[model samples]
Target chain A: MPQKNTLIYSNWWKYAGAALVLYSLIGGLLFVNPNNLLFLDETVRNLNYHVPMWFAMISLLCISVANSIMYLKTFNPKFDIIASKSAEVAVFFGIMGLATGSFWAKFSWGTWWTTDYKLNGAAIGELIYFAYLILRNSVEEQNKKARLSAVYSIFAFPLFIVFIIVLPKLASNSMHPGSGDTVGFNKYPLNNNLRMTFYPAILGWIAISWWITTLLIRIENLKSIENTDEN
Target chain B: MLLGLVSHNMFAQTTENPFYSNGKIYVVVAVISIIFTGIIIFLIRIDRKLKKTEKEINKKNQHKD
Candidate 1:
């Protein structure tokens, strides 16, 4: 048996949020607001929040896919619950990311919607996740629903990567900087302030997403138990 | 600009610009976000407690049966 940790129920993310706010204030006072810090461009200011959302969404999708694959291997309904709830959280964050990204674009690029590679790729990825929900719902049989959802979620992993990866390379026009240009990912400039805040924001968002997903899964499991008893 | 000089040519509507200089909008947004998180947390707790209660009820019924 695995050792039960008391820390599991601890509200760690609340403390993490406090630390993040404190760091943001200190960083602003010391490194950012001082020395006339113009390192991060005005538009890139939103990147601290928005970019991390995309990263977190992708990470949640990955967990959903992994749980799906596990369900396929073990033929377990428990794994299906994990997969479904994770997918639900992923889709929620994915849509929110898209909405916030559009807001950013509106402020920075003078348009609410654009054909930029990142924007378009994200739209398609949202559609793919939406399809997973639609597919699971349209089916009737309990076992077939679980089995088919598992199989479909497995395919989403590769399809998501392919759709997102291909857009940046395509000759299609994009308003995003370095869209058509073949600049190496590492060599592309990210200012020091952005580097520090961006990575931690992604980590924080990932933790928060997992927290939300876990809550949803427990609720779903409770509902299932109720259903079984009633039947 | 989406926001521009308002003219009397258009009928005056205070609620139309609810996001004016008033801090009310910000406070409302903050409250909503907090409430949303609180609701999710509350739902999870309720679900857990209900499940436990349901189990106990079922157990009592089973013993009677």
Candidate 2:
């Protein structure tokens, strides 16, 4: 029943760990052919990990936001915990995405921080997500916390879309691929051979990270359920 | 994507592109982060519901006891 299912989440690490190992091996094979890898200079290899992670992270956030809305609608405490837990997993991935991306940027853009539209927009997003976490902590009332957080989460999603998507298009031109007037957005063309590796990298990261984020939500839900029943 | 093959290009030992900076790195990173954050916010609600059910169960048990 619920108890039996709870065990599944507790042991999620096994699945996540195994997936990581598999991805690493796959990455290794792609890395073996450095010359033909995407980005041409071995720099695009970061996309395998970085790009997928960003997708996984956002996917996790999307789920979390949905859960938050449910909490507000149903006034359910369990929803809030699941939402919080998912955010934790999301944050973990997000930070990694940022780090790996910044590392790539240093090589691709000449500096860690750039004065371009896309970079600035991203920094703002990082701050907003960070603020989302902080805002959650600042509140104590269960009812109030759930309501306020839900409101904030909903508001934030659109802002993210605007900053990450819309604004970049309307702003200044950037050397950062497909940002401004770069016909077809920043879809950096990956070589066919490299695409073989890079595309899978995206798939692998998303599959693995999505599983972990789901596992985290399940764990928090179960643990909180146990705590309440015991009391 | 700019390798800056110009004369003053950064002295990259190999014919590697010296001008290629991680400019779009932030956008990619932000997109990743935004997605993750969205997921967590959703999960929080699920956790709260589970807690509610647990609470109801406990109340029933207390009355029975």
| Candidate 1 residue B63 C-alpha distance from true site, Å | 9.2
Off by over 4 Å in 2: A1-25, A28-40, A182-192, B1-65
Pairs in clash, predicted candidate 1:
none
Q: After superposition, how far is residue A129 of candidate 2 from its true place, in Å?
A: 1.4
lDDT of 1 at A187: 53
Chain B TM-score, all predictions listed: 0.47, 0.61
What is the per-residue lDDT of model 1 for residues B1-65, given as tens digits with 9 covering 90 to 100? 31232222111323333322353544654554566457556645754675476567557556755
Query: What overall lDDT, based on C-alpha atoms, would model 1 receive against the true structure?
Result: 0.64
- At residue A67, what lDDT does model 1 achieve? 84
For candidate 2, lDDT tens digit of each residue in B18-48? 2234344346545655664565455445646
- Once fitted onto the true fold, the runs of candidate 1 whose alpha carbons sit more than 4 angstroms away are A1-40, A169-173, A177-192, B1-65
